[model samples]
Target: MTGPAAIRAALPHRYPMLLVDRILTVSADEIRSVKAVTLNEPWYARLGEEPSKADFAYPDFLLLESWTQTAGLLATRSEEEPADGRTMLFGSMRDVEFHRRVFPGDVLEHHVRLQRAVNDTLVFEGSSRIGDEPVLTIGTVTVAFRPREQLDPEHAGRNSAPLTGSQRGEKS
Candidate 1:
């Protein structure tokens, strides 16, 4: 099992946002990880006494975030530690589906696979499950690593220009 220390070394996320708990397995093209959902999570802080079942249901977005973080770790594994002032950014998501309501006490196991890679951009496919039950399925998720300045227009300069179509492996 890969611990939080290794995750911290590869990812820039921190507490309250670092959703992945530990990696189960990793390979050149895929990774498996898990996140345990519990009432103690910050997302439940706003709930009052006698909260409804819906209140205990983990948010779909957080599930996706956790799964994507796993994908990011596998995608950048071969790189020489993440570069400074650079961050991984989601480019696109397609055909994603949430099949079940995940609640507290559920352990989400994510299986992510590297679909394709071209230069600094990567495409991934995966799914999340609670034991034998499927919870989330991702068709494709695209991500790219870019300088922080490129994401902030006010800070963007000649060196921070956005990638062009061809640069992103797209047809003109």
Candidate 2:
């Protein structure tokens, strides 16, 4: 079992973006994780005053992202730590489906299986549920190990010092 701290160490995500709340089980072939949804989520705030019915529903894209992040952890568990200045990124996803709406009180249970791993790319198949009700399904998902420098040209090379928000042209 992996708690929030361990999950934080294993994943680069944080705060409102860090979707997975806990990892119940993980092995070479499969993984199970959880995400506790609540009204405190940033998306809920984005709905503004007197939100509509659609605003109460969790966004489908974020549901997919949460599942993909869970798969990413499973995919990288067996591999050596990524080399300096490198990170794993979502490559692609296919046949993703949403079976039902997920609400603020729902606890998303994610189940992911290792479909295959070839070189730097890993493939997975997974689904999510809230209790006995199915919420999402993914036929196949792939993630790639990539160099930060290549992914962001502004980052310079492997040995380059990290840049601050202002240096990157963002408000501090």
Candidate 3:
């Protein structure tokens, strides 16, 4: 499984921000990544109670971020050019639905399907699941692509080929 370090190498994300745990599958226009739920996650504190049960829950915003990261991985991993100098900004969210509660140890899987891509925009439908049950789903979203030079300074960095979902054992 590709850990955070490998993901960082593939994508320009660092500690406290990188969300994808391991890429699990990838094709030309699709990618799936895994995020093994852990009790030590920073967001767990907001859960009110230390997740004593396997059925612990996660906040919706965090789940959305996780799903968004998966979408980025799909675009970066499958694209012909995955230069670190490029970045994607989430433009809009549509038809998002939260299903079952996601808890620690759930090992949530994100399946991102690229619906369309043209010019510098990409639309994807993403779903997060625990095994066969879906925990979250976003029907659609449009993300804008931009050169790293145009992004905020805090988002610039370099991660080479060691981060491809195919290169890493994480699958996509």
Candidate 4:
């Protein structure tokens, strides 16, 4: 990203957990991106036992969120020209597993593939890795796209929230 603000415009992330640093590649149904981790990260505050060694690390949940946002960039843009205006929701993440750690200074590349999308629902498979070694893989995610008015205000405050859980079940 030219700056954090640039990344914010590419997707609908605010404040903390907007992990993507810049977008490397994008298509109608997929996106590839990068995130540069640094010692100044919030998550590393507690994880780093040695304050002297500000060797920051990426958290699993946030990495997942990053991947979700990457897929979101694609999912949202896939229909950028559509007559209907539906917002992107993460839906349900299944089989999300972290294999390795992305430390400070490591630029992990995220590759996301769109599997399917029908009506307001979409599914995708994504993976994050450093070079040839994989760091995280999300097997499947099923989510629905609804108009912005269908969501609760509280769900926007936290990356994960109770209201989002209930709304996911209700299908907008």
Candidate 5:
């Protein structure tokens, strides 16, 4: 079991972005985590002075991100430290479905299982529930441990000028 402080140490997310509140269980193949949703969440404050019923619902994307972060922690549990300068990046997400609305005061329980891991890529199956009631399901999510240079816009695509005809070894 892990608390918020330990979860923060495992993941890079912080503040309003740090979604996982507690880790219930962890192993080589699976992990379970918790997140207590509350009206005090940063996003809820953006609903203006008078929020409506629609504004009370948590965004689906953040829900997915929270699940992803849980899976990421499971994936990296074996490593003594983050692998050099590599970081896990979401490669793909498929067959995601939301069964019911999630709101403040809901305690989200996220369960994730390792489907496969090949080289730097890891695949997982995940779901979330609110007190035994299913709230979200994801068929598969793929994440890759990639070098920061590959993902940083400042370093990527730095020198890609189009080649002239002469540069291509053809008549100009």
Candidate 6:
């Protein structure tokens, strides 16, 4: 079981944004991770007293983000380049579907598989589950690693045109 310190070292996400809790297992092509959800999360703070059960349900987008973060960790673990001064940019997500609503106290277990990799672009497919029941499934997700300087508007010359997804190392 890998702890938060290792996860933190591999991912750039910080508090309130770092969604993955711990890594259960990781290999060259696959990774299994988990995230424990709780009522104390910031997403639930906005609700009023005695909010409906539906109101307490975790946001779907956040669930996806957590799963993606797990995938990022796998990419970092397998890649040779250091993550320093580089940012992982989400290029695109396709065919994502939610099967069940997740609430506080549910532990989300994610299993992700590396589908393809070329240069700095990575493609992944995965699913999330709570216990034995499936919660979410991702068909394909593409992410790219880019030097931080390339993302800075100030550094990208004022007159220079913005780089397309291909130029940014994203697979079209």
lDDT of each: 0.88, 0.85, 0.77, 0.75, 0.87, 0.92
lDDT of 1 at 6: 95
Candidate 1's residue-wise lDDT over 25-101, tens digit each? 99888899999998899999999988988888999999999999999889778444465677788879999999999
The TM-scores of all predictions, comma-separated, are 0.84, 0.84, 0.76, 0.75, 0.83, 0.87
- Which ranges of candidate 5 are over 4 A from the true structure? 78-82, 153-172
- How good is model 4 by TM-score? 0.75
Q: Which lDDT tens digits does candidate 6 get at residues 1-172?
A: 8999999988879989999999999999999999999999999889997799899899998999999999999988767788777788988999999999999999999999999999999999999999999999999999888987778745656765787888878997
Best prediction by lDDT: 6
Q: With candidate 2 superimposed using the best TM-score fit, by how many Å does residue 153's alpha carbon deviate from the native?
A: 4.5
What TM-score does model 6 achieve against the real structure?
0.87
Q: Cα lDDT of model 5 overall? A: 0.87
Across 2-26, the per-residue lDDT of candidate 2 in tens digits comes to 9989888888899879999999999
State model 3's lDDT. Answer: 0.77
Q: In model 3, where do residues sit more than 4 Å from their true spots?
A: 1-3, 46-56, 152-172
In terms of TM-score, the best-performing candidate is 6
What is the alpha-carbon lDDT for the whole of candidate 4?
A: 0.75
Residue 170 of model 4, lDDT score: 70
Residue pairs clashing, model 3: 23-170, 24-171, 24-172, 25-172
Cα lDDT tens digits, model 4, 17-64, are 788888887887778888777868777667645554324556677788
Task: State, as a TM-score between 0 and 1, how close model 3 is to the true structure.
Answer: 0.76
Off by over 4 Å in 6: 153-172
